[model samples]
Target: MEFGLWEKYYIEILDDFGFSREGDEESAKLLDEILSTEGCLTLNDLGEIVGFSDKYIVFGAGPSIKEHISMLKENYDLKDYVLVAADGATTAMIEQKIVPDIVATDLDGNIDDILLANLRGANIVIHAHGDNIERIASLTSFFNNVLGTTQAQPIGTLYNFGGFTDGDRAIFLAVALGASEITLAGMDFGDIVTKYSRPNISNALEEADDFKKKKLRYAEKFTNWVAENENVEIINLKE
Candidate 1:
């Protein structure tokens, strides 16, 4: 996507959440710091992996994940498709001994689980954004095979395949890398919070406020946009 178009949408997203654009700048600086310390992989490397797996199953950290945990645990010949886990979903997949092929995260979820997945050889698509600067610093050192991403403008080596949240970003990444079919799992955009959500996030949700609801609204919007925009078939398993 063009940076101009991306900028327009990004600004709208910030407006929707009532956040400042300066936060993204702070996050990008932290990503620069991380690049100075650890070597980074380009989308080209990510593309090579996606080329082999034409089909994908994207897992999101939502209540439906717990509801369908049994089916996911069954395996059912999932090796044939690429497994993409969105942020916090890594922990749930790891606990099941199912390491995803790709983990699209912004380091806001479980940093330890993400680091562990990276150590285990999963391609980590580390997203840099305003809210995750400190978290990125804490976790970037532990990753070996890492790809850099940004929601803002792409600079130097960092690229933007396009999507706002990790869940939609996973779909966008797959679409960018040439997936013919993508299936969604655990991506419930509803009112209830998932049991596996980050403690801080869960606590916020306990209030039953619109904050969490609005975030899910953006997530749903981004994913829906990807489904409509991409040429591939995106099946929402939740439905």
Candidate 2:
């Protein structure tokens, strides 16, 4: 999709989900600065990566993720595809010792883990927003001079949470990365399972419901936009 049209839909989605346009604008500006300074490419860069992959998987730190991990390990070929990890899942990925091909996060939680991953030579995709622009910018030098040579490239993306606690930035990052058939795992937008140890477990169900409602609405709008612009297929990993 054209960046301009996608930006419009992004604004509309945020508005529908109770986000402020002013905040989004600020976030966009910060993202632009981060991308420009980091020498990152657009979704076009993702196209080059995607063209080489047969399939792609997006890993969310949802409760159900624990259950699917074993299956994913056995069924999927790790080398041929890209594994995109959301912010919260970085620690979990470490616990499970799953080396993600790429990591996306806003640095809200699990900073230690992110740092650890970078230290271990894992390619990290830092998430950025206006609120955290200064912090993200501060890390630019470290990521560029120190961590850049470790992985393929450190990336950053514009985040639009859609005002839903469950609307993970990882989803958009995966799409922007040009996944041909993006399968989501641990995207349970309902109750949190007892098996999961995330802090939001108590309110998982309520949060998931709210997130699902907003996600459904956004998907409908995003689907229409995609139909008119690009030929990308979006699928729920749980399904």
Best model number under lDDT: 1
Residue 58 displacement in candidate 2 (angstroms)? 0.4
Off by over 4 Å in 1: 73-75, 201-208
TM-score of structure candidate 1: 0.91
lDDT by residue (tens digit), candidate 1, 1-239: 45686678888988878776778767776786687567887777777765667898899888777555568567557878889999988988888888888999887777778878877878898888888887777777778778888887777667788788788888888887888898888888887665455546545234324877777787898788877777889888789
Q: What residue pairs are clashing in model 2?
A: 184-237, 191-205
**TM-score per candidate, chains pooled:** 0.91, 0.66
Q: Which ten residues in a row have the lowest lDDT in candidate 1?
A: 199-208
